[model samples]
Target: MKQIQTDFINKLGIGAFAYISISEFCGLFEYVFENILIIIKTEPKIIIWLPGIMSLILFTVIVIWGIKKFNKPIEIDTRKVLNSLIYLYFGILIAQYLFIYFGTDFLTEKYSAEFDFYNKANKGSLMLRGYLANIPILQFVVFGIILLKNRKTVANNV
Candidate 1:
């Protein structure tokens, strides 16, 4: 039983770390792609959308897995974890909106005549990217807190 619990915790830790790292990488890739679009004067809608969607999917999978694998029915604080997940989702939505609002410039500058659209779109996209980049770090902190609190409880029980 003890070994099983330890294994579960370790797996959760690894999964959480991987999710955060992947999210960061996706953000970096998005940033790079945005710059490339600007430099090459190419409108890459597919490239821009892919990373965002992939990150969202990855995040969902990890969160669900963590809940199933790490959560203890008797002692785990499900409310806290759920709340954090909700907040994270909200952040993602806000980031997406900002990205779309600001990112239109890449499309407009490259393919349209609206400079104002470009300015608004690029600014929004940059802001959204920054905001989205922070989410993985926030999630890491939340998971760390959960682990620490759980450990404290276990220690108290022992």
Candidate 2:
């Protein structure tokens, strides 16, 4: 686990992984905030985007704090391993979407009630949703493969 973390810091040449973390944080944060606004009537639909802006500010502070406090290099260990946190992140994301689809009354709400999932009218909107849903999973898979490759080569060689 620590080996995976360290390889990320070294390969990125200064914690570029933090940006990915921030992006995932923002994505999930925005989704949750939007769902909340859906449940509680808000004056303007623009309220949904407020979470993204605030989260970006908060994430900026975290990255700055990390830079100032925990900039130590990660020691690469030989045992190839996986980070469970990555799986948990994606699991939470899938669960969140499932909750929105079934647990929440979002579909019945007037804002989204009009859209017909089976009809061809909302293809653009549906396509956008599909893209958004797939992006994180695809990113995680790609990075996981890269990390695994790096770990095997580095750990075995040393």
Best lDDT among the predictions, by candidate number: 1
Instruction: Compose the digit string of candidate 1's lDDT tens values, residues 39-145.
Output: 55444443345455555555555555655565554554434544465566556556655665776555555655443334445554655566656656655565566
Question: Candidate 1: misplaced stretches above 4 Å?
Answer: 43-158
lDDT for 116 (candidate 2) = 32
For residue 71, give model 1's deviation from the true position in Å: 20
**TM-scores vs. true structure, each candidate:** 0.33, 0.45
Q: Write the per-residue lDDT of candidate 2 for residues 1-158, one digit (tens) a residue.
A: 98677676554533344445556665667667755554455433244345555555555555556444543445533122223334545665676678678755655555453323222333445444544455555445644554565564445543
Question: Judged by lDDT against the true structure, how good is candidate 2?
Answer: 0.51
What is the C-alpha local distance difference test score of each model? 0.53, 0.51
